[model samples]
Target: MQWQNVAINKMIEEAILEADKKGTKVVSLGLMNQGEELNIYGGLYVSRHPKLKVKIVDGSSLVVALVLNTIPKGTTQVLLRGKLNKVAYAIAFKLCQQGIKVATMHEDDYVKLKKSFNSSEANLVVALNFTQTVWLVGEGLTEEEEMKAPKGTLFIPYSQFPPKKYRKDCSYHYTPSMVAPNSVENLHSCEDWLPRRVMSAWRIAGIVHSLEAWNEHECGYTMHNIDMVWNATLQHGFQPLNLPNHTVIT
Candidate 1:
């Protein structure tokens, strides 16, 4: 089900209030898939200044599904997406089935929701739990917000997912193949459709790292085999983006 800004804002406000009680400002890290776009799923933290220091990472390497796996069962995660689509919803449904409570909303109403929610639900606060995961869609936070994230926030990009769903809502032209392989390519070549975004993202970084992570017995990573993609991008002088260790950069 598509989440309303009210629910997500409430969750974040609760998180912020708890932070305030601890005598700390609200520290949040937003990971988006785009570099220039700042429209988060509800535009809660849209930068008003052009010089807004946001850390625009190469989301080109993130896999939404793998990140989802990182979240524990029975926990609620605030999901921020630019364009809510069926594929994403399908993922959420699967999580709900696993007992995960996923919160969703449009980008425009984020800040307002946060204010209202915190006012209403004082007990529903999000503590600085290292294990808690925040899933960001569209673009990463500006440099300023990155520094504000609580100790253990995983910042990721949007290219990790197919562009079909979000591109329409985007004003700029976004090439899905810029980082990850196409869905058709994933289905026809890899025999696995689910992890296309994940595999495609890693392939952009370094093939060796991608192969290592995919071959991990415990995780069982799968996706379209696109090792040649690395050779092309690297040949063009594109360096690997410095992402999390769970993420591989060339």
Candidate 2:
């Protein structure tokens, strides 16, 4: 929706009012609602509004935090396929800090990355800039030629909608450890306000936001440092993989 559209803005304003009525102090805007191009920081508008009575935050920062925490330690060769947006850059920076070798390519070059690195060498593959047109079907493996990761390879793909259908043939088929949930229902109910991906982002954002709020008052210091925020959020539980039944090559 157009950011300046009076109807959409009014709807957001109304949602803020409703949240305030319920004594909610923090409000999170997810997905398109918080896009920089459309809204130019819509969360800031709600936060600065005198009548809103809520702290507003866009959850992208938290998503970055989760991705960092999800990556396994001692992982050396990492392939990042996505636009080098702020989120992608943040992930790269964090990985560098951890002494991991990182390679990044635009979405169009994904096939090249696939041909170049297999699970035997690449420790992890993260697909951040995914659109409907781009997905995670393996390069050559298909329904008839099922392949498994050469043990220890990890794949993490972000989806704004329901995840695409799983391909049993693909290497590294398991979900990321940090974002996994026991079931889809645990992620969100049908009545939830946002789609699953957006909801997940908002949920993770709330985790860090709550910590920052507490640290400010209790520690007399702000937790704006991403590293500290990451460590703090790690105390919260991250679910393990819920993979489909398939042979995982070791």
Candidate 3:
């Protein structure tokens, strides 16, 4: 794990250097790059680097905005499944603040929940980790059980399942990976598969941060500030979710 972190950080530093050479104004860290163990330290490294000319941003706020935007109109109950990382915790907190009821379960509890479910109870299920999402869809329940599952929506960042492999009749599925072409090259980067609108949202946030940084302006922004990020995403042509945007597993 220590070696992995060092390697990841090295890669990030190299990317930052490349961005500087290209005169890029900002660099945005995606997914695992902004994960719990690295976000703060990575930001500090970039901010303190004398030779780094570009600003560093993370996708946390943008992701929250996109996920919230995907919620169905009538969704009153939400289940957040994954390890309780910073991103998951923040998303849950915001949902509760908006008066939506939420339940949280770790990845280990997924099998137990799947077995106990007689009918779908959650209106929405947000799986923060791709592996956990795969487990939930594949081994977590039987086909009949999944078909009878009551969840209205399943939101995952990506999936390894083919488009036609999962039960579509049960829940609405949203994943960037689902729309990607069936080619190995297309699978190289998570960004390649992410829905265009979602990616647009993240880009918009990055641009805003870049502009602020360039102007020596402090907007006093943090990942927990959802409204600002959501508004920016809207400006970049993010379509609102149609209720029950259902699909089979990706």
Task: Judging by lDDT against the true structure, name the best candidate.
Answer: 3
Q: What C-alpha lDDT does candidate 2 achieve relative to the native structure? A: 0.45
- Best of the candidates, TM-score: 3
Question: What is the per-residue lDDT of model 2 for residues 60-147, given as tens digits with 9 covering 90 to 100?
Answer: 5555665665555555556654333345545555665566655543444444443433423242343342221212221222332122
TM-score for candidate 2:
0.55
Q: Candidate 2: misplaced stretches above 4 Å?
A: 1-7, 17-23, 41-53, 107-153, 162-167, 171-199, 211-224, 236-250
Q: Model 3, which residues run further than 4 Å from truth?
A: 18-23, 38-41, 47-53, 106-166, 176-204, 211-224, 240-250
lDDT of 1 at 78: 39
Q: How much is 61 displaced in model 3, in angstroms? A: 0.9
Cα lDDT for residue 138, candidate 2: 19
Q: Each prediction's Cα lDDT score?
A: 0.34, 0.45, 0.48
Question: Candidate 2 has which clashing residue pairs, if any?
Answer: none
Order of candidate numbers by lDDT, starting with the best: 3, 2, 1
> Could you give candidate 1's per-residue lDDT for residues 1-250 as a string of tens digits?
2255446555644554455456542132222322222223312432322222221112222233433433434446534444433224334444545555444443343344345334443222233432334444443323443333334444333433332322221121111222233322433221133323433433333333333333211111122223343444444443332232343212
lDDT of 3 by residue, 146-215 (tens): 3433433354331222122245534444432112223223233335433433333333456556644542
- Whose lDDT is higher: candidate 1's or candidate 3's? 3
Badly placed stretches (over 4 Å) of model 1 are 1-64, 72-76, 105-133, 139-151, 156-158, 161-243, 246-250
